[model samples]
Target: MKDHHQHELDSRYRRAALPPLGALRCFEAAARLGSFTQAARELHLTHGAVSRAVRSIEDALAVELFERRSQRVFLTAAGERLRDAAGAAFDVLAAAVRELREPPGAPALVLSCEPTLLMRWLIPRLPGFHARHPGIALRLVAGGGPVEFDGVDLAIRRDDFDWGRRVHAQRLFEERVGPVCSAGYRQQHLQGQGRGARWDDGAALLHSATRPGAWADWSRAARRRLPAGQNQSFEHFYFSLQAAVAGVGVAIGPWQLVRDDIDAGVLVAPMGFLADGSAYHLLSPRPIQAGSVGAQLLAWLCEQA
Candidate 1:
């Protein structure tokens, strides 16, 4: 056994050369488990192979790694130092392997879209999309209003279908806005107030601040002569939705964002009269971007909506 082990670690082998991968592998495993026997078990080798690997490593390093006591092995100061270094080195190697294995496509996708869509629609389904498209990674920047899309790959927007010619938008789904309120709020303040009469008088109107002029457009389309605007408003749809869900006030938001709420009975669109048919869009500076892999994502979104 001694002669065979000596043959394995030749004296002619240069110690200053790069360390052996198999020996480093054995060391990392043993360091992680803190037991050579466990490392041998995991690596599917006999305890002798693991011990030999460790011995070869120690010989190469010209360092004392362990103080053997009975059957148990303890890491010396030098072993502890090498363990830390080897762990970090393995982590870097694993990262490099992952990068090399990644498929070819866009390095990163910058998605700028409405806060409402980001939270309500897009985010919830992102994990599934990632599972299917492992090669693509998305970095989302949720901002209300026109994002300086100079560096962005794509922007998901909510606007009228006829958005002029400055920017190109692919129509995804037309949104319909109406009085969205919690079930409790409708029971308290809105039950049987008569169609249009409830909103005609002041009834704690929670206006969405993102779409300031939106209430007016809704009122006009529905021919609702609103007597007063209570002006309990919020800039973000997520906030306004929460407020409405909490039975604070009646908020006006897109059907797409509030669709789940309406379905789950968290909210109810009291008067469907406010449906204006404003479509959500995927806006891009150059329309040709829609033809890229990101465009495939857009196509999926349009189908889902």
Candidate 2:
């Protein structure tokens, strides 16, 4: 009686558009391994069951996932693309499961900042940070502007920030600004154009729209002035640097953000006179413990500065 009812329920579900989760899993595994037998063994199911699951998934998606020939199943181009996405989904699911299984104790460290800052500055130094404090786990939350810090632990801010009633406040470090361009670009246009050359003397300046006064600052320091009719603007400093990298123009880059690029010989400064301080602040709701990872990060940035 139970088997009959189960069969009826399964038939009803099959009539619906929803494909079985097990079938999707089997297909993903089969595509990754390029063999039904291998997928069956890994999934602890019979080879026939695995093959049926793969076929079911392909039919549901209306896409050809594999091409079988000479007793071997090879994933199609579509299957290869799907495999990467499926694998990523599996990883996220597994991580979520693991987190649920573990007992929760300390609050997760949620770091909010711009994508450029995270990619160019923070990510490279994260290895040393992990080595020193394995207990601290980081969640990189990125955006163009600051999000309301309701659920966030800390913010690495470069914009206007209001402490309001928050208990946390510390200056991370100031970012020094200077002329930065690809080494190739520096050698080409800026080569014979050093201290003797006027700023407007055929120098292609990459303007950053975000930092309104960067050109003015650079012009003053370089002992030159931008022509009244000259105009160029980029949405962000990151994009401005990218333009500079492609030899489009010379950009004023923040030392804190592009230090590694400079060190790696990817970018170089023609004149070092533009290194002026612009503060970046570390903000949170409350003060961290003296020896905590938050404190460590603060200390590290200061030392780097």
Candidate 3:
């Protein structure tokens, strides 16, 4: 009788220590998707429902989980911790279900990368990787900023933000940036100008919303003045680069992303690239084994870089 009573008390304590499962599910969805609206859509719930559920979790925990900025939301440090735990828990549950349903195949190496770099540079080079290593399966996710590596095997990021010291980071390559424009735009606007000439006031300047201070950073590095021309802003860095390719205006381009375009004569970088004091790094939760697939991928990436 005493053992039974003690077991009941233990069960009650465990239940009390855990948050409501529904609220936790909502919080996990919001954190993974990075948007309340998207989470609501995925879960077939109203936006208000998702918001209230997340709020309930926050209220119970007495901590803010997300930083609301205008129309976007970002996870806080505490939120990231919860996200990692929730993601790992969900992944384990999912894998168990899959194992019951079917035989397991080769485990995929999940790699998260910055969207612009993935679109502009990595995707173009992925064919070679696949061809070289036919046995290794890859699952790529596009993201930036702080990463939750619970379910993710690897992350490729520039050393622009502090991603904490808990994870092992392997430096991949130096990041070099420069102003690039379509060759046609250069012929029309800068035909007779020297490489170090100040940007022409008549030409437009293409700017990326993601990197608002890119031009300013380049100006400081090159010791040159920016143009007093009309500025056009794009929602993403890739959009700005595409606009530059279309002869819309000059855009700050990363060397690795624009190297092929420059070589193909699609774009011209009159002022050569300069190191922007940032380097790309591969992040992992644990040290990679020497002969593992992760190590092979890392070695291949370094060779490519």
The deviation in Å at residue 232 for candidate 2 is: 3.3
> How do all models score by TM-score?
0.58, 0.60, 0.65
**Candidate 1 C-alpha lDDT tens digits along 103-152:** 86667677787766776777656667767767666667666556457778
Poorest 10 consecutive residues of model 1 by lDDT? 191-200
Cα lDDT for residue 103, candidate 3: 47
lDDT of predicted model 3: 0.85
- Determine the C-alpha RMSD for candidate 3 after optimal superposition of all C-alphas: 13.4
- Local accuracy of candidate 2 as per-residue lDDT tens digits, 82-163: 6644654564465456445657756567777666676567756766765776666655566544446777777777644444
lDDT of 2: 0.70
How does residue 137 of candidate 1 score in lDDT? 63
Flag regions of model 1 displaced more than 4 Å.
Answer: 1-106, 160-166, 193-202, 227-229, 289-291
Candidate 2 regions exceeding 4 Å error are: 1-105, 144-147, 159-167, 191-194, 197-200, 227-231, 273-277
TM-score, cand. 1: 0.58
- Per-candidate clashes come to 1, 0, 0
Q: Compared with the true structure, what per-residue lDDT tens digits does model 3 show for residues 1-305?
A: 56988999999998898788888889999999999999999999999999999899899999998999998899875786577557655654553464455545678788998987876677668768878987777777778998889789999999989999888899999999998998888876663456646567877888988999999998999888887889999898977887787788999999998998899897999878999999999999888889999999999999888
| Best by the lDDT measure | 3
- Cα RMSD of all models vs. native, in order, equals 20.1, 12.4, 13.4
